[model samples]
Target chain A: EAGVTQFPSHSVIEKGQTVTLRCDPISGHDNLYWYRRVMGKEIKFLLHFVKESKQDESGMPNNRFLAERTGGTYSTLKVQPAELEDSGVYFCASSQVGLFRPTYGYTFGSGTRLTVV
Target chain B: QQQVKQSPQSLIVQKGGISIINCAYENTAFDYFPWYQQFPGKGPALLIAIRPDVSEKKEGRFTISFNKSAKQFSLHIMDSQPGDSATYFCAASIGGKLIFGQGTELSVKP
Candidate 1:
């Protein structure tokens, strides 16, 4: 099966500009999650989607960031008025809901590298 | 606490030796622990995992030793190879969300 796919493998934008990252999860996977890792920092969760419904979004940094998973398929994360601190690698992961899956079935995308200057 | 602490920030090991990375968490509610390996330009991928019920789990050249009482876990790479050089992250899972520790970069010299 094709793994999770993320578009715009790399992006660079000026401060206060807007940038959007896309992720297409594997078919039949019901759990989708977004994470970000700043330079020299650990990867941190941003949000989770369970079939288009947000299960948790506490990790979202602020109002400038928005995430949406439409139709329970692909997901988009938009950073409006991007700041220098927002520059990081955005990763999307998916997992199938099952009791017998291997290691909870987490598959991560290659991730989109965002740079704000 | 929600954080997972990891150290040392980086390591260098000779091939055919062992590489160890340690992590500790303060949340006892965490029931699952997993280690992820990431190469440059790639997202993290699961290397191995262990539950609180097990003190140790090994796969191939990878092993996860869990210390539930101390709320700590470590990843051991046996017969470390140059290919095993990468950034490794330790994460604790609770309610399907992972709390990750600072990553450790491992370099194995051939």
Candidate 2:
């Protein structure tokens, strides 16, 4: 099925540098999500993983932002000291459970365009 | 608190015209209402969805109109083209965790 897949896509980094964004879901997907968009705004939510725990991170926006889903399969978002509003565009999504299933569509990932300068 | 509220941030239909976009939500327990379609760099995609017992839900030319007591929801794009422009999001969820609406930049002009 291979859909959600993110990586370097684009990243510039500078301010206090330290960036890491990667996602590779869609293989038995257990639900993994993280979103951000801060150019003009509107695309929030920043945490959620169902296999490596962390069901929700309450939309993490602080603590230098860090996210990881190690054993549950692909996911990582780390922005240590990066600032400059931490640039934006970092989306990773996945879905596959069954509860509200409607073919469970939620497979975004063509994002990762952080340019914190 | 901005649960959702989308409107004419941008729109300019023409090619066979008929493109409407609107959204309003404040969490009525939200019953799934999705509508996403991004293009520029790509990310969103799921162009049509509706729930709330269904007030409407088409697919071909896209349509999703649900109004559970005015919680509002809409997205119509009948014959528009120009590849149907892009950027349009209106979301709401109850169990899958979604809550967006501040996008709409459809510019379908032939």
lDDT tens string, model 2, A1-117?
679999989999799989999899999888898989888768988888897889889889899988989899998999999999879899999898766545687778889899987
Model 2 over residues B1-110: C-alpha lDDT tens digits? 43898998899989988999999987688778888899998899887788888899998998888879988879999989999899898988767878888898999878
Whole-model Cα lDDT of every candidate shown, in order: 0.92, 0.87
User: Which residue runs of candidate 1 sit more than 4 Å off their true CA positions?
Assistant: A98-102
Window of ten residues with lowest summed lDDT in model 2 chain B: B1-10
TM agreement with the true structure for every prediction: 0.97, 0.34
Model 1, residue A40: distance off in Å is: 0.4
Worst 10 residues of 1 chain B by lDDT: B91-100
Instruction: Give RMSD (Å) of candidate 1 vs. truth.
Output: 1.2
Candidate 2 residues lying further than 4 Å off, grouped into runs, are A1-14, A17-35, A38-42, A46-57, A65-80, A83-85, A89-115, B1-14, B17-30, B34-51, B55-62, B65-75, B79-86, B95-107
> How many angstroms is residue A101 displaced in model 2 relative to the true structure, after the best TM-score fit?
22
